[model samples]
Target: MAQTGTAGPASIATGPVTITEVVQSALRDYPQIHVSQEEFNASVANIRLARTAYLPRVDGLAQVNRATRNNIFGTLLPQNTIPSISGPVIGSNNGGSVWGSATGLLVSWQPFDFGLRHANVKAARAAKDKADASVQRSQLEVTTAAADAYLTLIAAKQIEKSAAAAVDNWDVLLRTIHALSSAQLRPGADESRIEAELAMARTQLVYARQADESGRATLVKFLSRTGDINTSLDTGRLLSELPPGGDEEVPFQTADHPVMAEQRANVAQSAAQLRATERSWVPQFNVEGAAYARGSGAEVDGHRLPGANGLAPTVQNYAAGVNITFPFMDFASIHAREAAQAATLRANQANEQLADKALQEQFAKAQAALRAAREVAANTPIEVKSAHMAFDQAKARYQAGLVPIDDLAQAQRLVVQAEIDDSIARLNVWRALLQFDAARGNIQPFLQAVNK
Candidate 1:
């Protein structure tokens, strides 16, 4: 529920973008999200396939062939491609070739399977549900990752800015010390010390810039973008957004979480599979019907029929019957049932373990982290303000020859450290809130809170 910013016409906008926009872009283009969506679609197809067992299977058949109308006492290979003569077996060999055609339609319906088909369909549905949960889980993961990268980039930028500011301040101090040393009011050693401090500040700025660049690269990767990209993030607004109350705990239901839902669905699917395997021993009832007409090239008494007449339907037949099959000695079925039962038990145990242990530990850790981050964020601004005042007083005193260069340098370092700490503290609170939401298997609530 992070606030969505209006995007410009460009592929990569130049202005500040909100956290919500980055997450939206990632959700839209990330490969993992697309892959999970396709998997869910495949699961839907599987469900359809399983339901097809409840419907009748109808097939159409037609054949035309030309062969010598001869039946001998010798054996013949049984193959559809190798046409055979349709005539009564005879002691003498007399044959003639003619064309013949046959056509038929067959329907087979498993009218009942004693709940076996139903169980299979139910299992398929459960699998589909699990796949749906996987899609949600994938989205949550991608969103969380994108948000994290974005926050890290923001923190890096702040660090770079603070470093640059420190460099500028030290440069000014170096110039002041140089002028004082030229006038012999401050020692040359003080000027040299300030110069060294300035050099160190510049080096720190370079490192900060490198970190910033690396963070931007990671953010771009999360957004699924290639090549050079420039991101202008709404860092000020994001940092300003505060949590409702430091002591109030966020409400979360583990059972309703996507991870738990997925595991529960897995258990359900396994149970259904076990039920299906158990029902495999039940009697299976099927109804089959077929109607066919065929033309023969030879008479029943081994005489060849005339040319064109053999191509016409000379015989017609139809049959309908009910079949009931009971597996009386199916060792395979027994073993399969046992395996399915074991799998079902394993799935149940996994779900139970996650719900009882993993989820609770994660929730507790997130809560603790959020609380600590909030406390640090709340205290950092005061530290920064005090450090800034001290640095200003130290600089004024050093220029008046009332304080040593070491004291002044220490004050400057304190200011820079305080600024860095303040920036990190603010971002850490956001990161902790994100972790808290992720532990609950969703980020929507966190986004809503932050955006508000």
Candidate 2:
């Protein structure tokens, strides 16, 4: 027995419902969903790396040495000559070893170099900004795609329901024809015609199911998910109430468009790159130093004595100096790079313009589709009623033997066509709604309005 105060299986809601919910769920499970956030984080890391340029750098040093005494020659001496230690001799003997080592720290800072460092930092910052903007654009695209997929699923579900209803209506008409025949008022040929119509309706139902399944598959793929699309969609919630008003406006403003924002960022980045390149012609300055110990030597007749006077090791020395570098050539390459960046900037500008124009056209198209859909939906009820009345008149006349079964079948066909038309009109309204949502951003606000 079912538990008291417990909900039944039929009451449970399944899968994604709201667009926001769908997006959130898909992102939570899909690895590819984080591309935009990852891109933004990467840009932040690059910016941090670039900022390291402003900080001074320090390093350590170490080393070891070995001595050899194999024919170690020194300054040349005369063939045979005895000379005093203070005399101007031409030669010396070499045979000694020195054990010395030292360690020190070195630091360098860009004290001043025209504008080289500044330009590098500026370029890095521009690139970081561009990366950030790209992330935003990617995020917008994902959101739009998610919303579109969800809406498409909803539309397919609605069409399936319409097809099912159409089949049911045809079944009812067929049953009515049987009843009339039993009363001896309708021709037996009418039953055959109605059966044919029923078969057609079933075929349509099969096609509708296939279309709905195809739409669900597309939605799942777009969300980057793994699921059985045939069973994933929530048919029960397919026609959940839409925005209260049958009409809604299409947005035309571009202040929030991600593609436009990305283009603008590209332009700024390119401009900054150009500025950096222009500054590359400037000079750069750095300071360096080294220190060591030193020693002296003595001599004998045409030869220097080994460890003469016990002074065999060399003294260490210390040196410090500054270096300055300025580009004297490569101006041609620099100019070419600047030209390329300028061209990229122009291209980005053109892209921005194109995005604006595309937005305008999309806005107009969405508006037209929405308006047409509303008109069709508003008049569908009257069309359905008119078709029903015509079908009833034809049925009654045929039952009285005053009209042919073919005429009645034609009238029934008109009724079915009208029903199909109404269903298509409803589907079109939803399609238009989805398109408008894409153009404006998302349908969250509209959904909220409808709920309110």
Candidate 3:
């Protein structure tokens, strides 16, 4: 999905479950990645919602009513419970029923707000950026996990292979010792010892298979699949050679890391929120234009007009004005909010620094591990060769009655361990390389090298 270079079919397309294919599958199906993507979508919506503040607002209204057209002259304090009438008051009060109605349309818009709207939009955009970074971070996490599990399974497979081979060697040696004992050439105790060693090898093979099954279960979770990982993996490239050390020259860069980017986005979002709050205390200004129509069945002299006269509009009017409002007491609220946002901004900035440090430390550790793995990988072949030579010599000596059974048994065990070490040495190097690039916030180079 996010390839850095072209990879040949051997590593990317030949296997039933290639590393690239697994990573791409995880990216597509992982729930955490989808969650982050949804959050990003919501953040995008919030940006549009914030931008809506710059547009005009229009409201429509209509009404009809039948009531007595009576009015009294008196000043009343403002309250929400009672309805107010706008017509002039006559000297007398009359309850004679008549119909009355009114309707209007109002449009309000803020031509400017000293960049307050802009600050809100910026805040929303920063949140969107943070969510976007979170999505990238999640992708990296899932892919790293899939790759790790895949490699672990490969290691387990290698261990099992070696253990099985050990069991077979021990079995063959046991048969030979039994033959010698039957012929009165070797001690009967030699056969018992060989049996014990073969059992131990079988036990190790069982443990290796268990580890492999467990790894597959874990990998299946990342794949969001329902079954055990039954697909054949093309681990040949992973075991054939070490990921070339050419990438060792590229210096670690923290600024491009997704975790660092998310932290930075958090800080920016907090700063934007603070800016938006700072401008909230400024005066609110808006220009409004409205048009309306009204009708009534009663005349100004307290006389009822003709029937059904108020059912339709009989008069029309229009008005235009500007409004400016400032909440004098909002200063306290603004100060409290600004303080909170300032604290948040500082906290986010601190987290960003912490993330940077963490990435650097991880990279350092991974680099050291890679070097050690390479050294181990380079030395294992020699160990395997020596162990084979020693085992063969011991076997020959034991058959020639020149050495004790214990020496041959020890040599045989060493050969098995050596074989296992050789099998996993290259894989360990590949694992170290995976960790190295994971800490660097990009695994593309490692994946590309594997393809080669």
Highest lDDT, which number?
Answer: 3
Error of 2 at 72 (Å): 12
**Looking at model 3, which ten-residue stretch has the lowest summed lDDT?**
1-10
lDDT ranking from best to worst? 3, 1, 2
How do the residues 1-452 of candidate 2 rate in per-residue lDDT, one tens digit apiece?
Answer: 00112212221335644555555544443334456556666666776787787776666554333232123235656756732122344443455533323354566667776665676677667666766666655555665666667767766666677778878887988898899888877777778888998898899889989887787666665443344344454423224333344446533677676666677777777777777778777677877665544233333233323533223335455667787887789788898988987898898888889888887787788878878887887887788899889989987887677888788878877777777667656556665776776666445554354235
**Best first by TM-score, ranked:** 3, 1, 2
Q: Identify the runs in model 2 with alpha carbons over 4 angstroms from their true place.
A: 1-16, 27-32, 65-104, 172-196, 221-251, 290-316, 402-406, 420-431
Weakest 10 consecutive residues of candidate 2 by summed lDDT:
1-10
Model 1, range 6-80, lDDT digits (tens) per residue? 333335465666788789888877778778788888888899999889899899988877776656666677877
Global lDDT scores for all candidate models: 0.81, 0.64, 0.87
**Model 3: per-residue lDDT, tens digit, 77-101?**
9999877876778765756878877
Candidates 2 and 3 compared: the better one by lDDT is 3
* Cα TM-score of candidate 1: 0.85
Clashing pairs in 3: none
Give the number of colliding residue pairs in candidate 2. 12
Instruction: Quote each prediction's TM-score.
Output: 0.85, 0.75, 0.88
